[model samples]
Target: MVKSVPAWLRILSVVFVALTALILLAPLIVVVGVSVSESQFIAFPPNGLSLRWYSQVLSSNAYLGAGWISIQIALMVTGFATLIGGAAAIAIHRRQLPFSDVLATVFLSPLVLPTIIYAIGMLMFWSSAFGPVSPVTLALSHTIIALPYVVRTTLAVLAESNPYLEEAARTMGANRLQRLWFVVVPQCIPGLAAGAFFAFNISFDEAVLSLFLRGPTLTTLPVQIYGQLEFSPDPSVAAVSTIMIALTIVLIFVIDRMLGLTKFASA
Candidate 1:
């Protein structure tokens, strides 16, 4: 039988959990605090509270344009990553194809590689092959990075699901396409939802690829914020960061609602 925790040990455990929560939440709290600061500069434990920075961000053309661009690219990445990764995960789960392990690794290899390395490669490859970088290049690069997340999440969900599902479908006169559409896809829904959110998060926050592949007319929200931070940052940056954080939190809730957090925690 498992031993019961002593009272003092339990107290320490509570303290540890509280500390961990604080550590994880402190940075976001700081960002939100700074975003509401009345001061022009980014100062945590802000002097006073105001929404002036948020208003400034809303009124800024560059920020608005960059946000729109980021949204477009993230949506495209989500679509492409979900379709490709879902199909690839389905294929891998079957293990019908020869060298399935090798193929699985190939599909997930992008996740193992550093984003900076791929960013540089994509920039060089695109510049040399295509005339100049554009939103499409960024979208493709983001999709490449996001695809692995989708594949891994979908595969994780598939791995935990009933292995006999497809066979049962076959026994019920379901062909490959019907079995895939009905049983396999349904089982992977939780993983797909989690992975899609991750894809959108990555594409929205990605700066390395966006920076290197940035064209004269294309700028993502993260890239815009990076430029401002490198040159002249203010509470406006904090406001934008806070907005992104809010979006991420919303997606997290949505994912949790669609599929319990425990289901995709591994993913």
Candidate 2:
């Protein structure tokens, strides 16, 4: 039988957990507080709570336009990242492709490489080939960075799956495509959903690549926020950030509902 924890050890565990949660959530709490401040400028203690900044963000055309652009790009990145990353994970897991190890490394290389280096290279290449940056450029660049998250998540689920399931399906007269569709795909659903959430979150919050690829006409929410902070930031910026935080929280809830977040805890 497992031994019960000592009282002191249990107390220590609770304290540690509380501290960890505080560290993780402090910035979000501060941002939410600042967003509600009545002060024209951002204030931490929030000089009298009010929704005026949120109202300002809603009325601002620039924020609305940037938000729309960000949403569109994030949706596109989610699709492309899920498809490409899921496929690459399957190939790597099965060891079907030549140099599966190398292929996995190649797919995950973006996570290791510096974003600024990739951004500079993409800018130069796009400048020479396409002439100017566009939404497509930004979407594709976000996909490149977000792909590794999908691949890693999918691979985690795939690794935990029954290895003999495919062979058993073949024994029951299932063809390659049928086995892949009915068997492999079902096993990957949880991972795919998790990865899609990650892709959307990454794409939406991504600032560095968006900044590097931004043209005169191209402005995402994060890029717009960066510009505001550089010039003159007010509570409106905090409000926008709070909204983004809310979006991320909603996505997290959705992922948990769809895939049981606890299922991936060990992963």
Specify the highest-lDDT model's number: 2
lDDT of 1 by residue, 120-160 (tens): 89888988898798888999999999998999989888888
* Backbone N/Cα/C clashes per model: 0, 0
Per-residue lDDT over 1-267 for candidate 2, one digit per residue giving the tens place of the 0 to 100 score: 998999999999999999999999999999999999998777898999899999999999999999999999999999999999998899999997789999999999999999999999999999999999999999999999999999999999899999999999999999989999999989999889899999999999999999999988799999999999999998999999999999988987898888777876566
**Candidate 2 global Cα RMSD:** 2.5
Which portions of model 1 show Cα errors greater than 4 Å?
Answer: 1-11, 163-165, 168-175
- List TM-score per model, in order: 0.91, 0.90
Whole-model lDDT values for every prediction: 0.91, 0.94
After best superposition, candidate 1 residue 89: deviation in angstroms? 0.6
